[model samples]
Target: MISTKIPFVIFKSFFNGSIRIKLDWESLISEQVTINMSFFEELENPSSWYLPWYLNDVDEEVSYLAPNARQLTLADIPKAINHLNSKRRDKIQELLSRFINSTQPVQLVIATYALPDGKHLIMDGNHRSSALILAGVKARLMVFEMFGPLDPELLPDLRLWKD
Candidate 1:
């Protein structure tokens, strides 16, 4: 179950319109994709969506956290925030401020694909999602299953990107 906190009206429109279309992420990423402003404004509750990253209390390390590959909601934000240090918390605040002040549409890249359990693996945009939730702007995500846990490999891509 790909946990998503989408509004009823947008949900209806999403299935009925081009808002949520399935596309290849590789191709889609090349083109500039922006979430519609209406989508953000219509979110009923931004606090109910799930996030993908969490901090481990034992070693104080950050891990890619999820429940049975299920979605995490904004309701879970406080716990994640609480686990973070002052620096990380401050970053979230900065993102919230920028999101609130910007009139431009928020740019995002939500990598979606199916898991072995037949669940959808929603990856990327972890911090931005949290920031949006904190800013109280909600939007339904359009999921595209271009790849699973790995596209070119069998396990998670442990390699970090370098620009």
Candidate 2:
């Protein structure tokens, strides 16, 4: 839950300015209450990276995208939940409990970056990252840290960290 200060974020619209919303900076965004993706699994584009300061190298960036944020379509959350990664399925199931336990609004960061194909990328708020595709949540054009032109094919996958 957020108690410190209101933060800014970024958003990439699939239809309107809502689809994939993201946060900026690592500390501003809380650790995922749950992680649905396995170290070896492939994920949808529009992933996330966090840091104390904006860093261009993937090795220096922190945080990974959450599974709940990767739903392909935004028509229904119920349907998307079913497709969440299998390894951390139990962890994600606990999100509802977290919501029930607290009434405070959880803090999220919005990040905007440029992908290799010239498409813009939004990083942050895994919960709402796909909300636009799932629940049609509206956004206020959140602020973000923008990363210019990154190579999707060159970016490292989660497995790359398995030293």
Candidate 3:
């Protein structure tokens, strides 16, 4: 069983002035192939803000939190999806198949911002996360706690886009 006592380590500081937390999930699912989170580099200079393309039309206001990251269980998945404002059924099932049939473990980098009421607004990786829930996989997500406006231009240090 994966220990819930995992310590939260402040990983590194990014160009956009945000610190990522280094989480150790190696022991959780040893059979799964580990893919290091590399989306941070792509976010440094995005040609278009549409990389995390799903949020383009979302009009909700996002709240900020201090840099925080933690492990979320399979049970927490549904609540996170609820923040998206719409349940995407087809997209989740499609990703679910990819997750179950793949020979290698798929590393999903789910990012979310904290809501004022202590809820999370999943900014990216919703489909993958939902699929993981359906697959009954307990995974560690690299959830970046964001602050400020949702506008790409107004985001802190041009590090607004997520995937």
Candidate 4:
């Protein structure tokens, strides 16, 4: 049910003048998309919310690692969007309508699995990322590197991208 076995820690590093955060957590079980949604409540005003607020009810001992932030560009969006299913694609379209012409900078929590081929399998943030892409808005991504048993078959609508 996505319980953590240890306290989460955030590590910061400087790479080429940019800050990179590395988060390390243990024992996260990937679940179906709908089930995963229960872990975080939707914010009424997206701009007012930060990633940590979503985990307010989650036990501190089991926290998701927060890595440093990086810029998400237009070139990266299409590749990532290709990984989502039609259902998620529709949601992104919905969000696009609202986010279009939005000047507020977008920041997102992106979770991924590092693959052998150097690509990342996006385990979370498909909707937000997709919408941001459609709106032609660049974003700062706080990437969470997920380490555990992740079955793609369980989440048919995940996106894949190279960072």
Candidate number of the best lDDT: 1
RMSD in order of candidates: 10.9, 14.8, 14.4, 16.5
RMSD of 1: 10.9
- List model 2 lDDT by residue over 64-163, tens digit each: 4432222122222344455445432344455444544444543234443433343334344345434322322223333343333233322222122223
Model 2 clash number: 16
Candidate 4 lDDT over residue span 1-163, tens digit each: 1222221233112111222222222222223111111112221223222221111122111123222222233344454344434565578778887777567766666554444443444445546755765676555556554343333333221211122
Query: Per-residue alpha-carbon lDDT of model 1 for 45-66, expressed as tens digits?
Result: 4443334444453424254432
Model 3: number of clashes? 0
Candidate ordering by lDDT (highest first): 1, 4, 3, 2
For model 3 the local lDDT of residue 108 reads 60
For model 2, give the RMSD to the true fold.
Answer: 14.8
**Each prediction's TM-score against the native?**
0.44, 0.33, 0.37, 0.41
Winner by lDDT between candidate 3 and candidate 1: 1
- Candidate 3 residues lying further than 4 Å off, grouped into runs, are 1-87, 148-163
Q: Candidate 4: global Cα-lDDT?
A: 0.39
Alpha carbon deviation, residue 40, candidate 3 (Å)? 16
- Candidate numbers sorted by TM-score from highest down: 1, 4, 3, 2
lDDT (0 to 1) per candidate: 0.44, 0.32, 0.39, 0.39
What range of 10 consecutive residues in model 4 has the weakest lDDT sum?
32-41
